[model samples]
Target chain A: MKKNDIIVIVLVAFLALGIGGYYFATRTESKNAKVVIEVNGQLYKEVNLYEDQKVEIETSNNHKNVLEIKDGYASMVEADCSDQICVHQRAIHYNGETIVCLPHLIMVTVQSDEEYSVDSVAN
Target chain B: MSSKKTATFGVLVALAFIFSYVESTIPFNFAVPGMKLGFANIIVLVTLYLLGSKEAFVISMIRIILVGFTFGNLNTMMYSLAGGLLSFAVMALAKRFDGFSIWGVSVLGAIFHNVGQVAVAMLVLQTSALIGYLPFLLVFGIISGVVIGIVGAELTKRLRVILKV
Candidate 1:
């Protein structure tokens, strides 16, 4: 491989690994976290993680997402998106963890009170 | 452009549309929602080399619109448009650089394609949290990009001799 080829390969590898390491390393699990749901990028609902709750978020544009909080973990129990990827994703129960339904433009995140001050992403 | 050139562009566009449809029919998922083997890109890369970026851009635009209207939904169209445009731009720029071959340019195109879709996702969702998925997407992009790059490079090399552009 040429020097440029090597550089490009190494660059992509390092960028992915470095950012991935930082992302996962900084993610913390907090028992007292809150499940925050945002619809169309606006705050639609927020509830404590410990509460066993099923929040159905419906957007004005006919999209729907159901957020289920159980056993201190939050998951997208249901969504109207064609892919169903959000519904199939694993539960999120840690700080900075998010379950996103791209089609519905819905997001479900877990954050502790300390970390709840507008997630780094929200900013 | 000559009628012959127009015919070539039409054929390339048709090929790209067919490849994209075939790709969508593949059963297995890449684990990442927006990721794909991008067989359609091979045509785009080949067109870029055989014809020119202008013709390739036209082909890419038509492929997205035609395929989007027929087999896919508006959501699919939006993501494809956002991703295709960026991928086209990146590949066009990367192709101009001698240090990077078709392989590198194709890879860069793949990477930028993912970036563009993720950016749209972030905007649609209005949450940076979705950016969290970038790592997974990027890792996938690298593997797929390299594969696309190699295939694109080989295809471009072989086709150039036959087309004699």
Candidate 2:
């Protein structure tokens, strides 16, 4: 690679590392984490992580996703979408972590109750 | 296009198409969603350096549409189109500006490809949390981009003499 190429690579590498570092550093593990499920950008359900339950979501498009919350973690155990990408994503327990199913327009995000209260105050 | 140019474009497009098929079967289970080796980009890069930006754009578009029809649905096609379009645009701009090598162009294309997909994902899901995926996708893009660029550079060199373009 040429000098300019090296510059581009270094710039992108630094940028990636910077954003990644910030994300990890700011990650907070809440004592009362809640799993928020959204379908087509609307709140479908919110469940406590300690509840240990299985959530089955069926979108209007007839898409299906099975989310399982157990041991203080939330994960997509199964999905009927062709890619099954959400199923392959890692289980998340920390605030701001997400498992997204693009085909079904499903998003499973972990949010701490503190953020919920903050939203309430703002509202 | 002349008969020879038409034949060459056909061959290039076919090669890109096969790369897409091969990529789909590889089962890249990388934890992070939307992570792809982007093998088809190698052929697109080769086409860019060997032919021209216009030819490369057409070949890339044809490959995406053809692959979408063969192995994927409309949703998949839309994602691919976003990635392909953004990637090709960045690569073309990089090439036109000069200074950076093929590797740089490839890496930029790969990175922006992910960015484009993420943009669409954000709009579809209506959540900014998807930005969390950028770091992983960026790192993966760099790795895959370098590999594809290496192969593409070699192919472009050899094809130049073979095709005498």
The candidate that wins on DockQ is 2
Query: Per-residue alpha-carbon lDDT of model 1 for A1-123, expressed as tens digits?
Result: 356766887888888888889888888877678888877778988899999989899987988888888889888888887678788778888887888777777777887886545586588
Which regions of candidate 2 fall more than 4 Å away from where they truly are? A116-123
For model 2 chain B, give the 10-residue run with minimal summed lDDT.
B25-34
- Listed per model in order, the count of residue pairs whose N, CA or C atoms clash below 3 Å is 0, 0
* DockQ, model 1, C-alpha based: 0.47
Indicate the TM-score of model 2.
0.96
Top candidate (TM-score): 2
TM for every model, in the order presented, reads 0.88, 0.96
CA shift of B145, model 1, Å: 1.0
- The best candidate by lDDT is 2
Give the interface-residue alpha carbon RMSD of model 2: 0.8
Report the CAPRI category for model 2. high
Span of 10 residues, lowest total lDDT, candidate 1 chain A: A114-123
